[model samples]
Target: MGIRSVLSKPFAAFVVREQREWEQKAPDYQHKTLKNLVSKASNTVFGNDHGFKDIRTYDDFKKQVPVRDYEALKPYVEKMLTGQNDVLWPGKPAYFAKTSGTTSGTKYIPITKESIPNHINSARNAILNYVHETGNAKFLDGKLIFLSGSPVLDQKAGVNTGRLSGIVNHHVPGYLRTNQLPSYATNCMEDWEAKVDKIVEETIDQDMTLISGIPPWVQMYFDRIVEKRQMPVKDVFKNFSLFIYGGVNFEPYRQKLFDTIGKKVDSVETYPASEGFIAFQDKQDDPGLLLLANSGIFFEFIPADEYFNETPTRLSLDQVELNTNYALIINSNAGLWGYSIGDTVKFISKDPYKLLVTGRIKHFISAFGEHVIGEEVENAMKKTLESFPEADIVEFTVAPNVTPEKGLPRHEWYIEFSKMPADITAFKSSLDSSLQKLNSYYFDLISGNILEQLHIIPVKKNAFIDYMRSIGKLGGQNKLPRLSNDRKMAEELLKYKE
Candidate 1:
């Protein structure tokens, strides 16, 4: 083992031990985090507006500050963009993570000096935790490539601004900098396709070990590497073992990704967002990510079923129940108070507070009052894939076909397949049946003739890729919506129908 790997084991052990202690005391950490955030921002515009000074308890904080999505919070952000100080956070933000917004077009999420370590350290700890658990730190000696956005920042109100991934690039530690791949010049290329081509050239013959990114973009990079090397990615990077990813559910892309790599490797899934680094898969055996409760962010859970209610019940960490889906809200040091990041999660284990990202609060198909979530569809795909081993998925999305020209309106699944199922008809039946079993409402809708069985539309290869490209969201923290309530995306996808 290299010197770094030898030293890493002890450090990793220390980190793991520390993390366990905090995990057990997360409720205490969360209470303290809330108190700190409220106290620090008490003099700021948002704190004053929300009566933060009088917020003595979780109930008081909830009453004083309502849950607000990006649009709802944009006025304060606007003031900040115009060079206003202490608008949301105590001082001017150190940087702004520019993200594609839903209703607001473009969003600038603040990253304060206090909150930046939560993003950086959480990622580092995830790697260290992996090393601690598996006793495999040899990957540290090899090149680690994080397929991310350009590391270019723009000046906005005297603050550095860029994509979250790009902003993070600047903060990469010096030790890992030597082992990091895809030269800075290559990473700075804005065009994703061109950037991937350059990255393939730069790292094709390197001692690459750890590869990290959103699964789809990482798949694209693997495809390019295979095409260039004329071998599987595993063969090209024989030392490669760790695959770290976040941004979306990895289940749908799991089979295809391993197939392309030619073998299974240890992978870590994280829950890093522009808002904060919320969670990471701490245990190799557990599917749930351990919530980062002490990471400068106070969390609140609004039951997903009641999220659309006029006044959804918001519960603190101690009040959450196991196996119940909840919309995640945050009051963070970054000046976001009761901010809804749009994600929904489910607690699988409360002992150390481990949870799974179920889906998004806004991303669901409920046309006929059947709320089909991302987790259910992903689970259906995973189960169906097991039954049909030959089939491999490239990318897919689901949307409601509310105004079909034929009989009943239905859920349309636009899938781009790498290998089509041998019996497409049976595959469709199996997928639909799996989903129906997981969601009773969907099953009832189909049985009661309120909606037709889900229809699968196999689009041309790279259809989703092309669609994202057309919309200027081809790369860098842009996630394709898993499902939409409306038919806008479904209608647009028909052009690529095979």
Candidate 2:
């Protein structure tokens, strides 16, 4: 083993031990964190406006600060952009994480000096946790690559600004700098397809062992590698053992990714956002992600079913129950107060607070009160795939077909398939049946004849990819939504329908 590898084992052990200590005291740590955040930011503009000085308990904090989405918080953000200090948190923000917004054009989430460590260290600890558990520090000795946005950043109000991935690229620790791959120049390429080609050229001949990115992008890299090398990715990178991914659920792409790899490898699932790194898979065998409770964010949960209600009940970490879907709310050290990042999660285990990212709050189909979520669709597809071994998908999205030219209202499934199933009718039937079983509201709607059995629209190969490119969101942290309530996406997708 090299010097770094020899040192990593002990370092990993220390980090894991520290994490375990905090994990056990999560509730207490969370309470202290909230108190500290409120105390520190009380004199800042946001804290003053929200009555943070008077907050003595969770109830006080909740009463003072109502949950806010980006739109609600935009006024303060606008002020920040005007070079205002102590607007959100005390002093100027260290960086602004630029991300695409749906209603609002582009969102610039602040990354404060105090909060950057939470982002950097959580990612590091995830790998360290893996090393500590599996005794696999050998990957550190080989080249590693993160398929990310151009590290080259722009300035907004004299503060460095760019995509979260790009901003994070600047903070990659010194130890891993020598092992990180694709070169700085290659990563700065704005064209994602061209960047992937350059990345393949750079890493194809190297000793790459650890690869990280969103699943679809990583799959594209693998496909390109296979095409160029005329061999599976596993054969090309023999020591490649760890596949780290975040931003989207991996279940839908898992079968196709492994098939392309020609072998299974250890994988780590992470829940990262421009707002913060929320959770990551701690155990290889475990199903859910370990929530970073003690990390600089204090979490609250609003019941997903009641999220649209006038007065939704918000629960603290200790108050959350297992298997119930809740919209995640956060009050972070980064100066975000009661911010909803739009993600919905379900706690599978409460003792250590491990949860599954069930879906998004806005990304659901409730056209006819069916209220089907991302998790239901993903799970249904995953289960349906088990019976159709020959069928594999590239990308897919669900939308409600309220007014079809010739049929009753239905949920439209626009799918891009790598390999079509032998029995198209059977595959559609299985997918529909699986969805109905998973969502009782949808089942009831189907039985009542309010909505017809879901219709599958097989899209032409590379249709989704082409669509993403058209929108200028082909790669990096961008993700294709699995579900949409309206037909905007579905209508555009019909142009590519097979």
The true-versus-predicted C-alpha distance at residue 235 of model 2, in Å, is 1.0
List RMSD in Å for every model shown.
Answer: 0.9, 0.8
Cα error, candidate 2, residue 181 (Å): 1.0
CA lDDT scores, all candidates in order: 0.93, 0.93
Candidate 2 stretches greater than 4 Å from native: none
Model 2 RMSD to the real structure?
A: 0.8
List the pairs of residues colliding in candidate 1. Answer: none
Highest lDDT against the true fold, candidate: 2
Q: Which residue pairs clash in candidate 2? A: none
TM-score of 1: 0.99
Give the per-residue lDDT digits (tens) of candidate 1, residues 74-166: 999999999999999988999999998778998999999999999999999999999999999999999999999988999999999999999
Model 2, span 420-472: residue lDDT tens: 99998999999999999999999999999988989999999889989999888
What lDDT is obtained when candidate 1 is compared to the true structure? 0.93
